[model samples]
Target chain A: MPHRRSAFFISDRTGITAESLGNTLLTQFDTLEFKRETIPFVDTVEKAQEVAARIMNSADSDQHRPLVFSSIVNPEVRAAIKVDGALCIDFFEAFIGQIEGELVQRASLTVGRAHGMINEEKYDSRIEAVNFSLTHDDGVKLKDLDEADVILVGVSRSGKTPTCLYLALQYGIRAANYPLTPEDLDSPTLPKMLLPFRHKLFGLTIDPVRLHNIRTERRPDSKYASMDNCRFEVNEAESMFRQHGVAFISTTHKSIEEIATNILHKANLKRRF
Target chain B: MPHRRSAFFISDRTGITAESLGNTLLTQFDTLEFKRETIPFVDTVEKAQEVAARIMNSADSDQHRPLVFSSIVNPEVRAAIKVDGALCIDFFEAFIGQIEGELVQRASLTVGRAHGMINEEKYDSRIEAVNFSLTHDDGVKLKDLDEADVILVGVSRSGKTPTCLYLALQYGIRAANYPLTPEDLDSPTLPKMLLPFRHKLFGLTIDPVRLHNIRTERRPDSKYASMDNCRFEVNEAESMFRQHGVAFISTTHKSIEEIATNILHKANLKRRF
Candidate 1:
C-alpha cells in the first residue's frame, strides 16, 4: 500500500497562494496520496511553533517527513515553522530574495498584504460587479444591459451563472448571463433583446449528455432534463452564435475558472485585479 | 520615479495560479510599480514564443528586464518562454525537482491539469453551493435555512453578500446571508427564523463610517444610509451576536477573501475544494 503523507500549506494571511501553488505542484505527482491541510493567518511565532508541532506529529504518524509549503513573509515566524521532521518549502523565502536582487530593493515583509484591503476603490468595484452580475443574472434585468462588460448567452444548464460569478469575483468584470430559453432557441434570428448588444454576446454550449445529467439532478424526469431537449438547445444556441458572429465555447469538461478565463481572453477584456 | 517594469504571468491553463502567487510576491515590493498581464493557454511552443516576444518588446520599451512568472509544465513550451532580456521565474521549475526528490517519484508533467476539470463531483458541488447562496441571499428564501453550512447575519452593506458568495464559490460552502433590517435592529431579540440555527450563525459588523459610506453609494441621502442609522444597526447587530454567543468579525477593512477565510477558520468548516 502507498504511504499516505500529510502536506501542509501555511501562510500568515489567507494561505490561498500557498494552497494554489502547492496544489498545482502536487497534481504533477499523481502517484502520491497526500492529506492536505491549510493553516492560514499564522503570523505569530507562537502560532508558527504550534504548526511545526503539528507537522512533527503528522510526520511521526506517517513515518515520513511531511511536506510544508509556506508563504510566511516574516523571517522569525517562518523560521519557527521549519521543524526538524518536515521539508519546509518556504515559497516567499525562495523567491523574494531573487526578486529583491533583480529589482534592487528590499521587501516590505508585511503580513496579510496579499489578500488584505489594500485598495478601497478596487474592492468596492469588485463588490459592485458582484452586485451587478447578481441583479442581471438569467436575463432577469435587461434595463442595464448596456453596462455589462460581457453578456453570456447559453442554455439552461450550460454553465453560465457560475462562470459569470467567477468572472465578477475574480476579475471584477461586470458579467451578466442570459439563459437561452426554449422559446428563444426555436426562433432562427437572435433574441430581439440581444440584438443591440450583439457584440457583447458570448455563448456557452455544453455536451448534450452533460447537460442532461446536470438538469436531471435539478429536476428529475422533467422534459427540461430530457436528452433530446438538451441536444436541441445546445445545437440551436451554437447555430445562433455562429450566425450572429458571436464567439462561444463549450463548457463541457471545463472548470468555471477555465471558462471565465477563456471568455476574457477571447473577448479581450482587461482584468481589473 | 520608480522604474515601472512589466510582469507577465504565463501558464499552460488559466494562468490563475501564476497570477495569484506572482501578485502576492509583487505586493512586497512597495517602491516598484508593475504593469501586469496574464497570458493563459500557452500550452504550445508557438504560443510560448509569442508571449516571450511580447515580453521582449515590453523590456525594450521600458529599458528594464520584465519579470515572467510561469507555471507551464511542458518542457519545450516552457523553454520557449525563457527568452533573453526578461527574468523568467518558472514556478514549477523552482520547486518541482525538490518535491520530486522528496517524494522519490517522477512528475506526470501534464499540461492544463491545475485548473482542469479534475473532479466532476467537486465542481458540481461548488456550482450547487453558488446556487444555494444566490437563492438564500439577503434572506430571500428561508425555507431551506437548515441546509446552510453557515448563515451570515449583518446590517445592510456590512459586507455579508460578497463574503457569502466568496465562501460558496471558493470553498463550496453553502453560505446564506441575512440582513439586519431597521425593524430587527430596533428590537433587542434575534430574528425568530435565525434562533433555531443559532449555532451556525456568524455575524459581520462594519465600522459605522465605512457602513455609511457603502450605504451612501447605494442610497445617497436616505435615512438608511445616515451615519446615525449605520451606527445603530452595527451596534445592534454586534450586540445580538454577543448576546447569542455567536462568533463575529468586523469587515471594515477586510477583503471578501479574508472575511470568508476567517469565517471558515472560526466555524471550522471543511473546504470542499
Candidate 2:
C-alpha cells in the first residue's frame, strides 16, 4: 500500500500562493496519496505555534515527516512555525536571499503584501470586468459588444460561461459569451449578430457524447439533450468556425483554466495583472 | 534601482501552475522587477527547443540568467528545456523521483493531468455551484436558502459577490450572498429572511473610506456614495454582525482570495477538491 502523507499549506494571508505552489509540486508525484490542509492568516506567533502543534500531531500519527509548505513573512511567525517533526519548506526563506542577491537589494519582508490590498484602481477594474461578464452572459446584453476583450460563442453547454467568468475574474478580461442556438446553427455561415465583431469571436466546441451527457444532467430526456441534437450542433458549430475563419477550441478534455489561457494565448490578449 | 530579470513560466499544458507558483515566489522578492512571460502547450521536443531559444535570448539581452519555472512531464521535452544560460527549476523533475521511491510505484508520466478532464462529476458540480451563486446573488432567489453552504451578508460594496464567485469556481462551494440594505440595518436583529439560516450567515465589513471610494465610482454624486452614508452603513452593519453573534471579517485590506479562504475557514466548510 502507498503511504499517506499529511501536507500543510500555511501562510500569513490567504495561503493560495502556498497551496498553488505546493499542489503543483505534489501533482508531479502521482503515486502517493496526500491529505492536504491549508492554514491561512497566520500572522502572529500564537497562531503559528498553534499550527505547529497541529503539524506535530499529524506527524506523530502518520509516523512520517509531514511536509509543510509555508509562506509566512513575519520573522517571528516563521520561526515559530519551524517546529520539530515536520520538514518545513518556507518559500520566502528558501528563495528571498537568492532573489535579494540577484537584485542587489534588501526585501522589506512585509506580511500579507503578496495578496494584500495594494491598488484600489486595479481592484475596481477587476470588479468592473466581473460585472461586465455577469451582465453580458448568455447573449443577454449586446449593446457594448465592442468593449469586450473576447466574445465566446458556443452551444449551450460547451463550457463558455465558466471560461468567460474565469477569464474576467482571474485576468480582468472583459469576456462576454453568446450561445449559438439551433436556429443560429442551421447554416454554415456566421450568425448575423456576430459578423461585425468576427475579429473578437472565439468558438468553443465539445464532443457530442460529452455534450449529451452534460445536457442530460441539466434536463433529463429533453430534445435538447438528445444525442442527435448535440451531434448536429457541434458539427454545425465547427463548420461555421471554419467557414468564418474564427479560431475555435474543443473543451471536451480541458479545464476552464486551460481553455481561458489558451484563448488568451491564441488571441494575443494580455493579462491585466 | 534593482536589476530586472527575465522570468518565464513554461509548462506542458496550460502553464497556470507554473505561472501561479512562480508568481508567488516572485512576490516574496518584492524589491525586484521581473519581465514575465508564459509559454504553454510545450508538449513536444521541438516546442521545448523553441522555448529554450527564447529563454536564451532573454538571458543574453538581460546579462543575467533567465529564471524558467516549468512543469513539463515529458522527459524529452524536459531535457530540451534544460538548455544552458538559463536557470531551470523543473517542478516535476525535482520531486517525482523522490515520490516514486516513497510510494514504490512508477508514475504514469501523463501530461496535463494537473488541470485536465479526469473527472466529469467534479466539473459538473463546479458549474452547478457557479450557477447557484449567480442565481442567489444579491438575494435574488431566497427559496431553498438552506441548500447554501454559506450565505454572505454585507453592504453592497463590501466584497461579497466576487468572494462568492471565487469560492464557487475554485473550491466547488455553493455560496450565496445577500446585500444588507438600509431596511435590514434599521433592525437590531438578523434580517427576517436570514434568521432561519443564521448558522450559515457570515458578514463582511469594509472601511468607510474605501467603501466611499468604491461606491463613488459607480454613482458619482448620489447620496449612496456620500461619506456619511458609507460610514453609517459600515457602522450599522458591523453592529448588526455583533448583535446577531455572526462571524465577520473586514475586507478593507484583504483580497478576494483572502476573504474567500477566511470565510471557508471560519464557516468550517470543507473544500470539494
Candidate 3:
C-alpha cells in the first residue's frame, strides 16, 4: 500500500451489501487512503473479464496492489477473474460452504429473506405516491409541502414516516407525511392547503389493537398510544379515505413494501424515480 | 364495486411494480380509496401460505377484495401464494416464464460467480458491522454528532447524499453528511465541527475527471462542473482526509451502496433500525 489502498467492489447483483460491508472495515486501516470503485450487474464472463482487465490496467498504473471484494454469481466467470492477480475476497466462496452445510444439516423450510424488501427508488416512490394528495391547494410550491410526494392522512403512527422515507430513499421520490390530527379526521374538510391535490390523496389505517402495540414500542403508556384512541382514529381515517376518495393501505400486518406498493397502485401513478 | 375505486399494490417482495402499474390505471376507475398490503419475504411456501391466508381473511371481512401484486423468486412459493381468493399478481411471475424459456433454449451457467467471496465481516467487525446505520433521525438530534455510530464527510457531489440516504433507509443508521467547500480546502485544516470527532470523521472523494462528468449531467458546462476545478478540489480533499487522520473512500465509480458501505466500514457503526 502506497499511503493509499485502492479498493474495488465487484458485484454480480446490485452490489449494495458489498459496499455496505466494505465501508465499515476500511475505517480501521487509517494509514491507507481507500480509493473505491463498484462494478455492478457483472453477470457475464465478458463483463467479468472486462472488469479484471480494468483492474489489472489500473493496478499497473497506480502502484498499489488492490484489495478486491466481489459477489459474482457465475463460477466460470469468477475463475477467469481470479487470474487477474488482485487480492480477491469472494463472499460466495467463503459463505457457500457454511450456508450449504447449514441447509443440509437443518433442512429448514426457510431459504433466506431478501434484504429490506426493496430497492431505494421503488421503495421511495411507493411512499411519495400515497400521501395527502386530495388536500393540497393550487399554487403550493412542492418544497412548501414539506417535501411531500403524497402526504398520508391517517391516525398517529400508521407507518407514515418510515413509508415516506422508504419511498424517497428507494425511488428518489420526495415524500413528506403528516399525521391527521383528531380534528382533521373528524371534520369533513381536510387541511385547507392540501385541497387542490386531494386527487392524489392516500390514507393509512391499521387495526387499533395493532397500532397500539406499534406505538407502545416508541413510547409506552401514553394517551397517544392508547388502544381505544388508536381504534377510533384508524376507523375514522378509513371513513375519511372512503368519503374523500383517498386511496389507503392498512399497516396491520403488512410490511413497508406492501403498503407503499398498494398506495402507488391506488394513485395510478408510475414511480417518480 | 363500491361507489369509488381505490388503488391497490401487492408484493411477494414489495408491491412496488404493481403500484407503478396501478397508479396509471386507477384514474380510469371511479373515485377510489387506496388500499395497500404486502406479504413480506414470500420466498418460502410457508410464508406464501401465511400471505394467502391473510389476504383471504381481509377479503372476507371487507366488502371489496383488495388487489394484490408481488415479486417472489421461487416458483413453488409463487404458486402457493395465488391460492388465496384475491385478485393477486406476482411481479417476477411476469418474467419467470420468459427466463425459463431462455434457460431452456440456451445453456445457463449452473454456479453463480458471487459464490467465492470471503465474508469480510467474519474477521472485520468494526467497519463491516456499521456500514448501514439507520436514517430518519427522527430521534437522533443534530447536536449529537459525536454520538453517531458514523459520520460522513465529503464535498458536494462526492457521493454523500445517496450513500447517507442508503445507510439511513436500509440499515436505519442516522447518517448525516457535511459538505467541504473550497474555503475549508484552502485552509489546510479540518472543519471545526470535525476536530473533536476526529475518530468519527470519514472522508469521501472522487476522481475529479469523473466528478466533472457527473456534475455535467446535472448542470452542463457550469463552473461547478469544471474538470480542472474538480481535480483541484479532489486532490485537496484527499490530502485533508490524510492530514486529519480520517480514512477516506474515492467514489469515482462506486454506487451509493458501495460508498455507503465504505463509510460504514470506517465508522464502526451498525444499522440500528
Q: Worst lDDT window (10 residues) for model 1 chain B?
A: B111-120
Q: Better model by TM-score, 1 or 2?
A: 1
Runs off by more than 4 Å, candidate 1: none
- Across A190-230, the per-residue lDDT of candidate 2 in tens digits comes to 87888789999999999999999999988999999999999
Per-residue lDDT of candidate 1, residues B82-199 (tens digit): 9778889999889999988988888898866655645678789989999999999999999889999999999988888888889988999999999989889888799998888988
DockQ of each: 0.73, 0.52, 0.06
Which one wins on lDDT? Answer: 1
Better of 1 and 3 by TM-score: 1
Better model by DockQ: candidate 1 vs candidate 2: 1
RMSD of 2: 2.1
Two-way DockQ contest, 2 vs 3, winner? 2
For model 3, residues B144-180, the per-residue Cα lDDT tens digits are: 6755656677777776655665665555565656688
Instruction: Please identify model 2 stretches exceeding 4 Å from their true place.
Output: A29-31, B97-108
Whichever of 2 and 3 has more TM-score, that candidate is: 2
Best by TM-score: 1
Which of the numbered candidates is closest to the native, going by highest DockQ? 1
